[model samples]
Target: AYLSPGVSEHQVLDASYLASLLENSTSSYDYEENESDLNSLPCPQDFSLNFDRAFLPALYSLLFLLGLLGNGAVAAVLLSQRAALSSTDTFLLHLAVADALLVLTLPLWAVDAAIQWIFGSSLCKVAGALFNINFYAGALLLACISFDRYLSIVHATQLYRRGLRAHVALTCIAVWGLCLLFALPDFIFLSASYDQRLNATHCQYNFPQVGRTALRVLQLVAGFLLPLLVMTYCYARILAVLLVSRGQRRFRAMRLVVVVVVAFAVCWTPYHLVVLVDILMDMGALARNCGRESHVDVAKSVTSGMGYMHCCLNPLLYAFVGVKFREQMWMLLMRLGGSDQRGLQRQASSSRRDSSWSETTEASYLGL
Candidate 1:
């Protein structure tokens, strides 16, 4: 039932259709009775119930496993690279930590999905808070990484020695603070309740009218719009800097940033847009007619799938596009295979030479 960023729309629609088919028929049940039973329930609630029954537990199980392994490995690798902890790495470490925390909540979600939040009120609050906190923290850390890249490239000489460790720590604190503040509503609003029609107990949010509207608005701005704006601006400036850089090495760094930022944007933007639309629909700003409802349901299914897909994408991004990360991964693999380590040694030597050459070229450019 949770919306994620990587699931395909077709898969969601197919899942939904399959769920509907399952709920409506059995070899022994009469078609008329099945139709009558379905018609008696609220469409949205019935769809949600069916969807949860059919897909959510399995989906959460898969995500939990993926997130656990991927994020755990990311955290371990980032932590082990203590000597290479630049401002960029600092942000990345925080991002990995945030993502790992989010993964920790997945098991709870899986339980809730399968068994309808039998964990009670306190667990509900804790799970909801952790989920929101980690999600927003991850987003904020991504923005921080983008800004760090922008500054490192565009203001390289001036900011090169700027110690961002303390600043990054402070910013992380602020992000957590804001995340908690925003997430308080989830604590106050979400509760486990019994669904009378379905004869099932479940966890659900119960926002006051004003609070619900505000939460939706806040989600649109903080969760989607603000981060998008910041990432877009930083990457745009970074791209401009890269395009004009005289050094091939600098250009290469910029190109890497472009790929990272572009991948993030492409993966996340649709999910956010769909979330905004869902909020709008909830607020009655969108029509509630059958066609619109169907459209919204379809959109929800697609967006949720995509959002889940996002969780698996970050590790791939780091492994493939991050030159340092790729090197580290390759080294780790070679060690595991007990293969020749000469290639890694050669790469290290080549990297040192490249660094020396870059320094010389920079000195020449500055007439030093």
Candidate 2:
């Protein structure tokens, strides 16, 4: 039960129908080329088949630029310190790499969203695959980073430390493998299908009904929830450790943990909630109406955009916030200042009071 201030019945009804077909799974589903459905749909004036053509592309452009610069800086800084990279830094590097991969596809989607899918068929599939692969990869890498931090803090046993580099490498490999495996659906189902009404091709997934429902649920659980749970568990345990060892630093750890968790939830939960509601409504579990469906359709677009912000946020929350990273960046700046800046380097080196900076920094790298 909802109402828009301005909309016609045809607009509302067509919006509802288009919403159903957007992320839906159906054996009989095809592009809107079927003239019968298109004739009836008539492209709603209120909630057109396409999202806000201007706003969505602008958002994508913004995310692409921010993600590129932020993730690029992270990768460059991390690689520059390759010889001294800790386990957290290694995971952060991979996370940046995954973010860059996802960002690269945003411009393509931006163009497609604004106008039409002019990329033809093959590139459409490749773009779709890149979207799915790097999405899963980024989430999986975040969870991996959390788990690595958990192990180092919660159970820093000698055995665990033995061949730690190898362990980190292997874990990253496994994450990529799982991401590509999960994204196999895109490879199989994502393609450019012609829509007659629009007389344009769209890059989208075409899953059977049951498969669509399952994939939606799987994405909810695997793409977001499971990774969230892993991060929560690791942070909770890490917080427990900090609480036991009482200090001002403990409070900082608590704040960082809360900030990280809250940021993630705020950024991602709405999209998943909208998706879940869509699934439920489609299954007749929720009261369905044209008005509500239209609202949800609008929501799905906005929430999905919000979710993409994670690529830009990752470097800030997970990489640049570390004390060691901040110091290293400063050192890099000093080094980049030409030969006359040698004094800055000497002062920077002389200011290091703790021989155990690496150990302490590892603890802080998880936003300590």
Candidate 3:
């Protein structure tokens, strides 16, 4: 059941306590009334089972396949071009790694969602932890990319060259560290258990009494609010610098950064907002009664689906949005076809011709 908005976190705690109380007392029998009511009603169990078997699993399977292919291609391209690595490329590499790791857990989830969490308790905990690691790492990497762009464009000569290698290594290390730290809750809390009513095993978080509130708060801060604030501030600084600067090429690059930041915000904002709202609702600030259960369910479903969709969107943004990336991809493709040497020669010739033309035009303009 979903919690109502505007509900105090304490209320959610109380509700959980109440649930436990009910489970231990006459309230458990009350659930039997609800179940009997549900069972007495005509429901298409066979059709539901069939849909789960045929449609849901197939859809998730397709998602897994696409995610693997897309992320794998990105990793290969980034690794192959390691000699030309920039701050952006460093972040992209981490992003690709995060996506690939996240996708690896999809098969487990697909099986759990379609049939059951056939995997044992250990697998469930590990998969759940990996999922969180991927999510947090991706978010942090995106934030890092935004800051890197801001530094590169606004501070340019000052911050771009000095300590770059060290900065890249540190940022990469910090991102992974934060990912593991935030994912620890998932590893600690996730479990697999058989549900008697559903006659299937489920894998989900099981927060301890002492740590539940702390976990929720940590999730709110680390998973959503902190990253959002970082991204927003970095992009704001980038915009301010762009507006104050005058170079056309720099302006164009700033525009691309803006696009990336905006896309990231748009894609992720709703999901986080939903999560925050759900947390609030769980606390008993929203709807207190059981009548609003459907609304909670809908919100949960939408947020969950949107969060998953964000995983697939990152590769497209990274690989397709920038001119440099496009050029790199084209070069990579040509090289894959064994024409890299010819392509390099063509590029060299074009560069020389452009340089000669620029010099001649300058001389003519000066009448020299």
> How does residue 132 of candidate 1 score in lDDT?
78
| Residue pairs clashing, model 2 | 33-196
lDDT of 3 by residue, 127-161 (tens): 88888788778888877776666565446532423
lDDT of 1 by residue, 70-188 (tens): 87777666665554455555666677777777777777766665666677878777777778778777777777766665666556632322254577667778888988897887678
Which sections of candidate 2 miss by over 4 Å?
1-51, 158-162, 334-337, 340-363, 366-368
**Alpha-carbon lDDT, every model:** 0.60, 0.69, 0.60
- Top candidate by TM-score: 2
Pairwise TM-score winner, candidates 1 and 3: 3
- List residue ranges in candidate 1 displaced over 4 A: 1-44, 157-164, 246-255, 330-368
Our tally of clashes for model 3 stands at 14
> Per-prediction TM-score, please?
0.74, 0.82, 0.75
- Output the lDDT of residue 344, model 2: 60
Estimate the TM-score for candidate 2: 0.82
Off by over 4 Å in 3: 1-59, 157-164, 245-255, 340-342, 345-368
Q: Candidate 1 local accuracy as lDDT? A: 0.60
